[model samples]
Structures are given as structure tokens and as C-alpha cells.
Target: MTIHVIDTGFFKLDGGAMFGVVPKSIWNKQNPADENNLCTWAMRCLLIEDGDRLILIDTGMGDKQDAKFFSYYDPHGDATLQSSIANAGFQPADITDVILTHLHFDHVGGAVHFSSDGSQLLPTFPNATYWSNEAHWDWAVNPNPREKASFLKENIYPIKESRQLKFISGDSPFANIDFIMVDGHTEQMMLPVIHYQDKKIIYAADLLPSSFHIPIPWVMSYDMRPLQSMTEKTNVLQNAVNEGHILFFEHDPIYQAALVEQTEKGIRIKERAALIEFL
Candidate 1:
């Protein structure tokens, strides 16, 4: 089995929103914001190859939104979802499974795209089964006002329309993969745990978006339940330290993955490096 880092690209987000209550005086040092206070973040996805399954963890924000929408979050970078997949020696048709962490635009946007003639929206991976939990699927589609903007219909509805969407429950069909459900970020956000050889790699999704967010209190403002986010993060971090799990960060602009250690200051990043280094 092998895994590849699929970097769709980078985009800007309000640093304050991303860091929640964490003061800019502190988070600025961690990520450093621009004049407009927007910080750059990567829409990093994961591609796993095991047996006949070519699994993609999350699809970054696609380029389907209009200029007005794009102006809000300046999405810029050379690496695109298609380019990155091709870089890993595969094409959209080669992906057999797409595990959507959640339906947030930045994470699921690339899962669908405009048809060649721009006549209709369609699934980006024409032959793949898109995985999303029933709970989260419902939460996104009938989104509360707070998260409605992030859960764009164009980024979601097409998969179900294509009849390729499946809800995950109990054990996954894929070998060496397990799902961890956390509700603090959104209802039933699924984090994929990949058991590779001797190590367990957790796709950190929005649960622990970046190494900087490893601290219990650095919850994002976007989360529906901030206090619950802290509690879930503590439990996940404890398990990560105890079991020597490597966290594959999804939104961290610089670091791809990290290992945590139980420090006197609570769990903290032991080292941050490229995902390949962990393998």
C-alpha cells in the first residue's frame, strides 16, 4: 500500500475566524496574516492506494465559484486537484473511492466540476463512489444559518444526483481504513484512520486542522460547538500521543503532518515534516 499527498492549492481565510478566540498577537506568529488579515492555507487532500482501490480522502475547493465568491477567499496556487492526481500517476477516472470528510466547500468542492460544455455540474471523479455519513449529509444539505455559506449546493448535490453517494456505517469496505466520527466541528464529521504498516495516520480534517491547532484551546470560529471541539480535540490528541499516531493536516499551509508528545504544557507537536518523512 502507498499514499500520496494531493495538494489542490492554497487560499486565504480570515485569520481571526480560523483561530477563533486565539489572539492575533499569538496566532500571527504561528501563521502570520496579510495586511487584510487573511492567512493562506492549503487545501491538502490525501490519495491512498491499496489493492484495487484508489481512495481520495478530501477534494479541495474547486474552481467553479464565480468571481464575487472567489474574491472573498483568494484561491491561488499552481497545483490543482486534477494536476495533483495526475502527478501521482493517476487520473480522475482512476479514483475508486472519495471519502468526503464533510460537505464544507473547501473540502468537498473539488469532488464535482462543470461539464466540458459548461452545461451541467457533475462529479469530478466520474467512476468513483463518494462517501459521506448520513448525519453530516443531512446537516450540510439543510444547513443552519451559521454554516450555510460554507456548505454550497453546487459542491454537494451533484454527487447524490449521480447516484454514486454512499453513507458510511460500522466497518468500511476498504481494508486497513477506519472512520472516527466527531461532532464538535459539524454533525458527524468523519476522520479516516489509515493503518499503514506499523503506524496509524489520522486524516486530521477540521478536527485538528493544523499542528498549530493541536493545542486544546485553538478551536476554529467556524465550528458550531467550540467547547465541544475542545473536548473532542483533547481526546483525539491523547490517543494520538499514546498510540504514536501521525496527524495528516488538511489546512496547514506549511506542514503536511506532525507527531505529538505529551508535554507539561499539554500535548504539543513533537515534529512537523512532510508526510513522506513519516512513511
Candidate 2:
């Protein structure tokens, strides 16, 4: 199987919300904010190419939102979902499965798009079965007030409406990958734990967005259950260390992947490198 890193681009978000209770003085040292107090983050996605199957994990926020909506996030980058896939020698129609970690705009926005002439919303990957769990699908469509802004209807709905959506109901999401469900960031966010080249490679969605967030206490404020997030992170870190799993960071601007070590200071990165090295 071959794995590809799809660069969907970058966007800015409030550093305070991203770092939760962590002091700006500390988090700033790890990911410094701009003058407007926003930090740049990568909306990175992963592609799994196995015999006759092309699986994409997480579609970055698409370009369908209005300018006013985009002004808040300040998305700026040359890479795009389709262009990145093309760079990998494929097209949107080539994807056979799309595993959305969660329904947040940044993760699943590109799953659906505005149809020709912008008359209607449609599934972005015409030939793929978009995957989300039953619980997350319900949670997203009937979103709570806090998360409503992140779960836009245009970014979702269309996949199911287009008759191309599937739910992971006590079943495997895809081959060569195992799902790890965590509720800290959002309800039932599925992290894809991939077995590639005899290595346990984890696509650390929002569970461990960046290497800086590996510390158990660095939970994000956007998380509905911060304490649960901490506990979940601690457990994942422990297991990752024990199993020597390499983590593929989604929102880290620079480093692509890292291996963890059980240090006296708790779980920390042992080695960091480009995703190509891990693959």
C-alpha cells in the first residue's frame, strides 16, 4: 500500500481556543500567534492507495464559504484538495472512500461542493463512499450551539443526500486501517490507525493535532469535554509509546510526523521527520 500526504492548505484560528488552558506565554513558544492573535495551522489530509482502493482521510475546509466567513479564519495557501490529489497522479473521481475524522468544516468541508453554475450542493468525490459514524452523523446534523458554527450544512448533508455516504456501525471503515474513537474533541471523532509497511502509523486527526499537543494537559478549549480529552490523550499517548506508533499530525504547520518516547516529563517526541520517511 502507498500513502500520500494531501496538502489542502492552511488557515488561522485563535491560539487561545486551540491551546485551551495552556498559557499563551507557553503555547506561543511552541506555535507563535500573529499580531491578530491567530495561529496558522495546516489542514492536512492523508490518502491510502491499496490494490483497487483509494481512501482519503479528512477533506480540508473547501472554498465554498463566503468571503466574510473566510475573513475570520484567514485561509491562505496555494495547495488545494483537488490539486494535491492531481499532484499524486489522481483525481477526485479516483477516491473510493473518504474517512472523515469528524464533521468539522476544516475536516469535511471539501467532501461536498457547489455544483456547476453554483445552483446546488454536491458530493466532491463522485465515486467515493463518504464515511462517518452514525453517532457523529447525528451529532453533526443536529449540532449543539457551541459546534453549530463549525458544522456547516453545505459542507455536509450532500454526501448523504447524494446517496454516497456510509456509516461505520460496528464495522471496519476501510482496509489496512483501524478506527480509534475519541470523544474529547468532538463526539466519536475517528482516528485512523493505519498498518503500513509493518509500521503502526496513526492519522492523528484532532486527537493529537500537533506534536505540541502531545502533552496531556494541552487540550483545546473548543473541546466539549476537556477532562475527557486529557484522559483520552493520555491513554493514546501511552499506547502510542508502548506500540511505537508514528503519529501523522493534521494541523502542524511544519513537522509532518513524529515518534513518541515515555520521558520523565511524560510522553514526548523521540524523533520527528517528513511523512515520506515514515511511509
Candidate 3:
């Protein structure tokens, strides 16, 4: 088995919202904000190759939204979903599975694209089975007002319309790949736990979005339940440290992956390195 880091691109978000109630004085030191108080973040995805199956975890925000919508986030980067996949020696058709961590636009937007002349939308991966959980699927389709803006129908409906959507019920069919269900960020967000190359590497998705977010208290304000986020983070971090798991960060601006150690104060980053080193 092999793993590749697919950097879809970077986008901006309000630093305050990303860091929750954590004071700007604290988080600002690590992730410095722009004049508008918005911080740039990477939309890094993961591509896993196990024999013939090329599984992609989390598609970044696609380029289907209008200029007005794009102005809000301002996604700008040299890499794109198609470009990154080709860089990894694969195409959209090569992806056998597309695991959506959740239905958030930034994560699942690249899963679908607009058709020619912009009349209809289509799945980006024409031959892949898009994976999402039933609980989260239901929650996203009928979203709460707080999260409704993030869950766009354009990014979702195409897969089911194409008859390739698969629900990860009971347990996932993919071997050595397990999920950690976290509801704090969004209802039933599935974080991939892959037993790869004799080591357990966690695709930390939004649960631990960036290396700066490793601290238990640095929860995102967007989370539906902040306290649940703290508890989930603590448990995951404890297990990560105890079991010696390398964390694969999705939105970290700089660090690709990191090792954490149990410090006197709490869990902290031990070393920051590329995913290839861990592999």
C-alpha cells in the first residue's frame, strides 16, 4: 500500500471563527491573520493506493461556485483537484472510492463539477463510488441554520443522481480503513483511521484541522457543540499519543503531518514532518 498527499489548493477563513473562543492573542501567534482577520488554509486531500483501488479522502472546494460566492472565501492556489490527481499518476476515473469526511462545501465541492455550457452538473469522478454516512447525509440534506450555508446542494446531489453513492453503514467495506465518528464539528463527521504500512495514520479531517488546532481547547466556533469537540479532541489526542499514531493534517498551512507527545501541560506537537517520512 502507498499514500500520496493531494494538495487541492488554499482558501481563506475568518481566524476567529476557525479558532472559536480562543483569544486572538493566543492563536494569532501561530496562525497570523490578514488585515481582514482572515487566515489562509490549505485544502489538502489524501490519495491511498491499495492494489487496484485508488481511494481519495475529502475533495477540496471545487470551482463551480459563482463569483459572489468565490469572493467570500477567495480560494487561490496553483494546485487543483484534477492537476493533483494527475501529478500522482492517476486520473479521476482511476479513483475507485471517494470518501467524503462530511458534506461541507470545502470538503466535497470537488466531488462534482458543472457540465459543458453549464446547463447541468456531473460527478467529477465518473466511475467512483462516493462514500458518506446515512446519519450525516440526512443531517446535511436537512441542515441546521448554523451549518446550512456550508452544506450546498450543488456539491451533493450529483452523486446520488449518478447512482454511485454508497453509505458506510454498520462498518466500512474497505480493509484496514476504519472511521472515527465526530459529531462536534458537524453531525457524524467520519475521520479515516487507516492502518497503513504497519503504522496507524489518522486522516484528522476537521476534528484536528491543523497542527495549531491540536490543543484540546482550540475548538472551531463553527462546531455545533464546542464542549463535545473538546471531549472528542482529548480522547483522540490521548489515543494518538499512547498508540504512536502520525496525524495527517488536511488544512494546516505549513505542516503536512506531525507526531504528538504527552507533555506536562497536555498533548503537544513532538515533530512536524512529511507524510512520506512516516510511510
Candidate 4:
């Protein structure tokens, strides 16, 4: 099995929301914000090539939204989903499965795209079976007022409408990988832990967005249930440390993967490394 890091570019969001309850004075030292008070973050996606299946996890905020909508997030950077896939010597048509951890615009936006004529939005990976659990589907489609803005209907719906939406077996979402269900960040947010080439790698989807988020209290305020998130963080961290799992970070700007060590300071990141190192 081979894993590829797909760079979907970067976008800006308020640092305060990203790091809940954590003082800006501290987080700024980690990822500093711009003059407008928005901190830049990478929308890093992952593509897993396992035998005949080519599975992509999270699509990043897509480019179909209007300029006015984009002005708020300030999406920047040269990396794009298409280019990243091409670099891996594949095309959108070749993608067999798209596993969306959640329906947040940044994570699933790249799932859909505008038509060349700008008349309609369509699935970005037209040939792939898009995966989302039944619970998250309900939560996102009928989002709470707080999260409604993040779950854009245009980015979703089109996948189902295209007749490609599939539920990861309610029995178990993970086929070869283990599905770690985390709810503190969102309802039933699924993280995939794959046993690849002698190492176990967990796609640390927003549960641990960056290496800076390693500390226990550093949970994001945007989380619906911060306390639950804290508990989840502890569990995942301890397991990662004990099992020697490599965490595949989705939103970290510079670091793609890292391993955790139970440090004196309650589960600190051991090393920041690239994804290719594991392959």
C-alpha cells in the first residue's frame, strides 16, 4: 500500500476558534495570525493506494464557492487537488473511494466543483464512491445554527445526487484500517488507522489538527463538546503513543505526519516528519 499527501492549498481562519479557550498570546506563538486576525492553515488531504482501491480522505475546501464567500476565508496557496493527484500520476476519474471525515467545508469542499460553464456544481471525483456515515450525514445536512455555515450544502448533496454516496458499513467503517470515532469535534467524526507497510498510521483529521494541538488543554474552542474532545484527545494520544502510530495531520501547514511520545507535559509530539518517510 502507498499513501500520498494531497495538497489542497491553504486558507485563513480565526486562530481563537481553532484553539478553544487557549489564549491568543500562546497560540500566536505556534501559528501567528495576519494583520486581519486570521491564521493560515493547510487543507491537507490524503490519498491511499491499497491494491485496486484508490481512496482519498477529505477533499479540502473546494474552489466552487463565490469570490465573496472565499474573501472571508482568504483561501491562498498554489497547491490544488487536481495538481496534487496528477503529481501522484493519477486523475480524478481514477479515484475509487472518497472518505470524508466530516462535512466541514474545508474538509469536503473539494468533493464538488463548478461546471466549466459555471452553471452547476458536480462531484469532483465523479467515479469515486463518496463515504460518510449516517449520523454525520444527518448532522451536516441539518446542521446546528453554530455549524451551519461550515457545512455547505453545495459541497455535499451533489455526491448523493451523482449516485455515488455510500455509507461505510455501520458495522465498521474501516475496511483494512480501524475506524476511530471521535465526537468532541463533531458527531461521529471517523478517523482511519491503517496498517500499512509495517507501520500503523492514523489520519488525525481535526481531532489533532496540528502538532501544536498535542497538549491536552489545547483542544479547539470550535468543538461542540470541548470536554468530550479532551477525553478523546487523551485516549487517542495514549493509544498512539503505546501502539507507535504515525499521525497523518490534515490541516497542519508544514508537518504532514508525527509520532507522539508521552512526555512529562502530558502527551507532547515526539517528532514532526513527512508522510513519504513512512512509505
Clashes of 1: 0
Q: Considering TM-score, where higher is better, how would the candidates rank from best to worst? A: 1, 3, 2, 4
Off by over 4 Å in 4: 171-175
Minimal lDDT window, size 10, model 2? 169-178
Model 3 clash pairs are none
lDDT of 2 by residue, 1-279 (tens): 988999999999999999998999999999999999999999999988988999999999999999999999999899999999999999999999999999999999999888889999999989999889999889999999999999998888788889998889776856688889999889999999998877888888998899889989998889989999999988888988998888999999999999999988889999888988865
Using Cα atoms with residue i matched to residue i, what is each candidate's TM-score against the true structure? 0.99, 0.98, 0.99, 0.97
Q: What is the TM-score (0 to 1) of candidate 3?
A: 0.99
Between candidates 3 and 4, the one scoring higher on TM-score is 3
Q: 105 in model 4: Cα distance from truth in Å?
A: 0.2
For each candidate, C-alpha RMSD in Å? 0.6, 0.8, 0.8, 1.2
Rank list by lDDT: 1, 3, 2, 4
- Residue 217 error, candidate 2, Å: 0.3
Highest lDDT scorer? 1
lDDT of 1 at 130: 98
Better of 2 and 4 by TM-score: 2
Measured on C-alpha atoms, candidate 3 has an lDDT of: 0.93
| Reference-based lDDT, residue 100, model 1 | 98
- Write down the lDDT of every candidate, Cα atoms only: 0.95, 0.91, 0.93, 0.89
In model 4, the clashing pairs are 20-221
